[model samples]
Target: MRVQGTPDELVTILRETVVSLVRRDGPDLSARQLGVFLTVYLGPGPHTVRGLAASLNVSKPAITRGLDRLGEFDLVQRKIDPADRRSVLAQRTKRGAALLREISAAMADAATPQENATAPTNSQLARSV
Candidate 1:
């Protein structure tokens, strides 16, 4: 079946498809939780809960709660800072890396057709470095 739509429509469809795929492959993660995970994972090395909360403009409690959830899923690990006993750092686990790979593959697959067909792909939405 041929799908006829504007570029915007296709972009939206591709975004939704990728989002759905990520959600399906990974444990049930809310948008907020996913955002938290990405922010922590992509942030500077050895991210502390307080640092993440500051970076995300959220409360420390919220960050802790989100980290707790990620911990429950075994996607993130919390370690007490050796230098500072009072500080805790959150790091992504192997499972989290694997999940990220799955999401990247799903997103790439969703964009492949339009990208190869000379149409702008969802990757275009990503800001160039």
Candidate 2:
């Protein structure tokens, strides 16, 4: 029998795919964790922990924990904010960029055929990353 639900209905499937793909090449990360990492890596300008938390719609302590994990993996670095000695900015290390590239490529690959089958091309995924 064929499944009846729309592809959008399979939230867990999508989440698992992205999580598994990321963990395959790098540290294990939840969806939220990955989102936080991406925000710091791809976000414009230097990002404070508070700013990242705000952007992610999460609490500061959550952001701090995520950053602490990323730092432990050596994927992110904490630098003294030049404008504010008491504050710090989270920067993506080269290792982090490489991992991001790998994850992006995997996500792009997983998305392309499905997207192309329904649309003219995969430009949305391309532009997203």
Candidate 3:
């Protein structure tokens, strides 16, 4: 079922997804790092530290710090722009794509209602009789 895009519902989903991520055996990304990761993966790439800083409304140093954390997870990589020696580009990795898929699954699970939790079972019915 599709989730209603209410603010409360959205916050619940975010909370659930974050909890799932934390419970799993994976890198725990900070808010800034996650933001950088999402932007690089979700948005059109060829992304640079300067461009990310501008798009994210953060400083270049902040973007670099975020990228440094992401790089440790192998979620993102930085390479010199071939045409421009002065520029460095953030590149996507296979691991990063897999992590994105995991996040999507977590969000999907968060959005879906746990019907079994609220549904009455035959055992409960017998007990009530």
Candidate 4:
């Protein structure tokens, strides 16, 4: 679908999507955690804590803390890079993929307007007359 919107409309869609996510019964991720999760899942592979910190312009400890939170929910996992044992690679999990699907669904739903809620139906207008 062609998605053309003003800045305000875009913000409204974002707000609705976030509200839907917040209401769902699942792992609640902070902004930082979500950022890290998205980066690990969407970005190129061979991701490390130091690399993520550099990509996000944050400290290594901050990335580590976000990874710890994501790990608790099993959204991400860390493994030692065999090529370089000293470096740890961040990997995506099935649960994380599922969450991304849910997020996409929520955004689609939010983008589709609910006509019933936004306007009065013909039957209601007739009854009032």
Hey, what RMSD does candidate 2 come out at? 9.7
TM-score between candidate 1 and the true structure = 0.72
Candidate 2 has what TM-score?
A: 0.72
* Evaluation by lDDT, superior candidate among 3 and 4: 3
Worst 10 residues of 2 by lDDT: 115-124
Query: Which runs in model 2 stand beyond 4 Å of their true positions?
Result: 1-25, 114-129
| Candidate 1 lDDT by residue in tens digits, 1-129 | 576776765776667665666568458776677778888777777889888888888899999999999999998999999989999989989998887777667656664555345544455655442
> What is candidate 3's CA lDDT for residue 92?
98
Give the 10-residue window scoring lowest on summed lDDT in candidate 4: 117-126
Q: Candidate 2: lDDT of 11?
A: 41
Residue 50, candidate 3: alpha-carbon lDDT: 94
Among residues 3 or more apart in sequence or in different chains, the pairs in candidate 4 whose N, CA or C atoms overlap within 3 Å are none
Overlapping backbone residue pairs in candidate 2 total: 0
lDDT of 1: 0.78
Q: Model-by-model lDDT, in order?
A: 0.78, 0.75, 0.91, 0.88
lDDT of 3 by residue, 56-113 (tens): 9999999999999999999999999998999999999999999999999999998898
Candidates in descending TM-score order: 3, 4, 1, 2
Error of 2 at 45 (Å): 1.9
TM-score for each model: 0.72, 0.72, 0.86, 0.84
Reference-based lDDT, residue 8, model 3:
57
